[model samples]
Target: MNNKEPWLAVNLSMLFPGFGQLYSGKALKGYILITIEAALIVSTVALWVQGSLGGFLTGFGGSILLVWNLFDAHSSSRSGNEDSFETSRKAGKDAWLGIFLTRILPGLGHFYMGQAVRGCAVLVLYIAMNYALVLLSGSVAGAILGLAASIAYLAAACCLLYITEKNPLRYPLLHIKYFIAGMSIVTIITFSGALLVRTYIIQAYTLPTGSMEDTLLTGDHFIMEKLSYNNVDSTDPGRGIGHGDIIVFTPPGTPVQEHVKRCIAVPGDIVSIKNGEVFLNGAKLEEPYAKGETTYSGIEAGRIEGTVPQGKIVVLGDNRRNSLDSRGFGYVPVENVTGRVILLYWNTRQILKMDFSRIGKVR
Candidate 1:
């Protein structure tokens, strides 16, 4: 074999980005030791500059270039010493395989080939980045950041391929380890965040109709707190839906139609509708939001003179005539009640002075 050209490697590495140093047997140069390491920096800068997924163009370009540079350096450094390199290169087939897998699944490629530690780190970073994108600001800029950061992975894969070809016997096991570690970390984080979001934060729901007109208009976007009524333990399931709660529930008969209405009477409460007015416990319940003092004039369907069953609540809309509420379908059971509406955020065009009063506490 010819004597290794250490001087040539150094010159090339120093002259052409990562080449000269790598050719000089400085493995760190072509191995993403600097460029790959700078991935986090690029990501941070991109986020800081663009601020969201929409502004990721700068960072995306930088990332792709960075990855391309790394690959070029690796290729150029291996150009000389063809025979000696050829012998070393044959063992790298498995490493190339690892790199190939990394392209599609990030750290999984490495883990599949058995590089557990590196694969775990990559997987952790990947999951964290994706979580941040989903939770904070889901603009197109975040998408670009994700795309740009992916280039480092490509560089890592390229290097891994070369390394594996140099030592095929050891590459397969390392790749597999990386794949498993990456998958494990990703699975854990994904489910963890899902549980957290589902448990604590409010969810956005769209209101279709104007049953509760002047209060919750149609095309309104509102948020409902999930844990506000989840306090019912196994000891007492009846403690969920209380009186005065604006609940969303499906009536007993037509289970498919979900309606949102104010709960006026709980189980055993005496409810009476006289002259289109609601009476609870023999006293006239004053509704300030009702359009007028009128009874169900033509419709003889919903008026009731009965007691609320156990675990049921009588619900009615503020718009007495236009609404088809519990008066029509009967009372709603506590089990079908999902949660209470805490806020109202109607569409701007649907209501005037919307910007000034778009959001308000729900009745």
Candidate 2:
């Protein structure tokens, strides 16, 4: 009796690319779909990281596959024709369910497959590994750690899928109580991970104003890496903030808002403006990227500046005449800095008129 529900198959496929096919008794097709989806995803991610336009286009294929999978699962369920290669479902263990859960979180699939102790251990290890990687970000070591973590996650997922398919365990993973518990766990872990990544790894922000002008225009979307100045001595010019570096930080009076500006002078450097030209340590600073005419309107206007106080930095926007930076808000404390802008990945000026050339590293 083919008692499969079409909606149920569609829902399973929605959870993970081949899960619906597996539920509809097309295991061979399901496996093939999963492999193709995985390959597309990995390739897309890698290419995107390298700032390739092809990566952006490659994402369309994944979307197409997802839609097709959903439709196929629904049709297969409605037809009630089980493939000869379909494995017996008499065993309570579901390889598709295990793989889907693992896709959500590494150890979750093991728990669904009746390996409770192993799951718990793997869960703890996965959390610890992620924490360590976050701590190590922004260096060669961090890159290596991230790669190793990816490999480890892939290996664990593969092992869980294989074991669940071969073991035929009587785990009641589909029970309402267990399913709810699993979902709840996944929710908590996912939220925590997102928060951790945003706080310590990287974050995306859009420029709402043209304070940066030629360097960064209004409606430009860029990614800032939080790891560069994290836990490092800001006074050290070699390793910390340096001249001409663009940074994002909370202004002195504005705790709720962030401003992006170029670092003009670090601690111990004297800064002043003569006429409309900036002088750093008694020498006229040459700024080729600066836009518009400079005017003496900020708080530091016409003031004979002394050495920048320790743990402080002088910042100014590329659009000198239009910016409200350290000149208007005073020297920004090192602690207020959130991150350094690394790339301008997108422009939200208009949906149909996006400038693809702007998608590159920020100087």
Which 10 residues in a row give candidate 2 its minimum summed lDDT? 167-176
**Clash count, candidate 1:** 41
lDDT of 2 at 194: 51
Best by lDDT: 2
Question: lDDT (0-100) at residue 61 of candidate 1?
Answer: 59
lDDT of 1 by residue, 57-131 (tens): 444555565556545554554555566555754443345445546655778767866778878888787777777
Q: Which 10-residue window in model 1 sums to the lowest lDDT?
A: 7-16
Q: Per-residue lDDT for 143-168 in model 2, tens only?
A: 66766666676566556545654432
Off by over 4 Å in 2: 1-6, 18-186, 231-239, 281-284, 302-306, 360-363
Best by TM-score: 2
Q: What do the candidate models score in CA lDDT, each in turn?
A: 0.59, 0.72
